[model samples]
Target: MTDETLHLRRLRSPIGRIEVVGDGRAVTSLAIERDGMLPHDGEDESGDPVLDRAVAQLEEYFAGTRHDFDVPVDLHGTAFQRAVWEQIVQLQWGEVVSYGDLGQATGRATAGRAVGGAVGANPVPIIVPCHRVLGADGRITGYSGGEGIPTKSWLLEHEGVPHTVPASARPRATDVTAAELDLPADAPAA
Candidate 1:
């Protein structure tokens, strides 16, 4: 065996809370916190240098200083799942693509359902841009961020993607600009 161990970190952001899991050298997962996402205890490798580095990189991403992640993520799942996640990483920073569009992008145009399933199972959330995926009618759909559709809305707003929502439903994270958030909006600070 490679003696690999998982590392993790928790981050609180204006969009809500997030949990990141890494494999020492690269981030493997980035999950948005929902009400039921409690801290897990086992080998709380939260303080590991590799995990800390991943957290720092994530912070830079949130600040808009980074656009691409440069860590070796150990994605776990089926080939279809990997394909879906890989396509997500190719999404433009401020662009949104529907599930059908994602299917087409992945060369699985007829596999829209499978694409949705893969997106739902995305291990890395924000970094993978899973939030960029939407409904065929341009509506926000699911998000692993716990808030589900609302999290998708928040992420779209954060990326400057135009979306329809009730006035009261606007994302609060929008109050802060990319600069205020310390993000560059053009590239990654990592």
Candidate 2:
């Protein structure tokens, strides 16, 4: 049997660095990590066309001219997880949905926790919109990205989604922030 090779590529975005993976014809996964991040364990065949396209699309996204990804995607996950991720793609640009709401939207009302796990494993982050999913109390929750909840909050703000942050959720002005990405916070939301 011929082994299917997974190809990967790295791209820099306004948010941070991204690692994209593909199987020649379609994207298999896309992740946002730190500047010096490396590809998944032993999965670095960066010289592939699919990866190149993914990187290009990401560049367009960061430039603020693209809203959707057109490249084919080969998502690998259980049926439930796939369902959750599929629902994620339906989130509107400046809207946020709670995990419980997503579970109900998928007809799995009792599976909110399962949906959260699926969101955590979303192969494609921005494109699939796991960042749009919030906690039961309409607050930011977990983010697979290393920077954690802060990344989630930043993404929501960047998208112009109004997040209801608890008083304790507020960050100090000097706390190593990503807020500087788009200068002049009042300069128009998206």
Candidate 3:
């Protein structure tokens, strides 16, 4: 059971600090920094039931142990944004889709820029898998969520996809988790 207040919490990942917001029943928003100020300080990981579940899932994801997220989501977006987000969720782990392609998937084949706008505003990045979306030529463009495009590439690499990082940058394993890695439980056999 939860009090009536909206929930928020800070979770430290190998990448950086993550701020999560929820309404007790479902996660509403997740950001890298302490996402905007709320009325009440949300309980820590172990104290809030909703937060505890979210943190656990995120930790498992960073460890490359879980692929899909099963938690309920409470996204507040316009109808078009909701449609785009729904398409994003359909993307399987390790799969990447171009912005134009996403527009097509949402039956808005000519709304590529509009699609990009929605992708940028995606309140939840990882679990909804917004990083899985890309620009033309399958190259990464702007990704302001979490730790930025590096985290996106890292996520792709973790998913066993050959993703290109910025410049000569390569994501070190330590950027993901501190614990010894578990042999990627479900990385697709190449």
Candidate 4:
């Protein structure tokens, strides 16, 4: 594998400034800038084509004009983490998958907590859509990116799911029908 230097560029967004990092072939990471502000007069795009594509897609997303990302991600993770990330990628737009559901989807029925760990460690947060993962009871749970659970709720809301509520007051999880998730009738939620 060629070792490419990570190139980073800044993109201004309604929520804040997002720093995008990538090699020439694929985007490696996109994270919210800590200050939530962009410089007033500098160039807003990273010159790399891959990063530019990601910026455009993300802009479309925040504007409600696009629902899914098209840019490829050079996701770095352990084998198990990669499996977990794949399931995250397969999640349909506007659909929220519980951590337990994600674990079962990856054939690790008893590894929900482990899957949650992997999800939190995801390198590319928004593009990979780890924010769509929820608790088993439909309650919003741990989110390590940006503003944490609030950020998770924001992303979910952006995707047309208004399931955000304080953890203490979250409603009971909606019935996770087997048909909706494509699991066998004998599967956990089935």
Q: Name the 10 consecutive residues with the lowest summed lDDT in model 3.
A: 173-182
On residues 41-125, what C-alpha lDDT tens digit does candidate 3 reach at each position?
4554433687768877887777666788888888889999999999998888888889998899889999988999999999888
- In model 1, what lDDT does residue 182 have? 46
Candidate 4 lDDT, 115-168, residue by residue in tens? 989999998888898988888677787777665666666677666775656855
- Clashing residue pairs in candidate 2 (N, C-alpha, C atoms within 3 angstroms): none
Query: Which candidate has the top score in lDDT?
Result: 3
Model 1 lDDT at residue 48: 66
Question: What tens-digit string does per-residue lDDT give for candidate 1 at 52-156?
Answer: 766677677666666666666778899878988887888877877789987887788999779989999988787788888888777765565656766677667
Clashes of 3: 0
C-alpha lDDT (0 to 100) for residue 172 of candidate 1: 47
After aligning candidate 1 to the native by TM-score, how far in Å is the CA of 47 from where it should be? 3.4
lDDT-based ranking: 3, 4, 2, 1
RMSD each, Å: 4.9, 5.1, 4.9, 11.4
Instruction: List residue ranges in candidate 4 displaced over 4 A.
Output: 1-4, 35-46, 167-190
Full-model lDDT, candidate 3 = 0.73
TM-score of candidate 2 relative to the true fold = 0.77
Regions of candidate 1 where Cα sits further than 4 Å from its true position: 1-4, 39-45, 166-190
Q: Give the runs in model 2 whose Cα sits over 4 Å from its true position.
A: 1-4, 40-45, 164-190
lDDT of each: 0.69, 0.70, 0.73, 0.71
> What lDDT score is found at residue 72 in candidate 3?
84
Model 1 Cα displacement at 30 (Å)?
Answer: 1.8
Candidate 3, residue 54: Cα displacement in angstroms equals 1.2
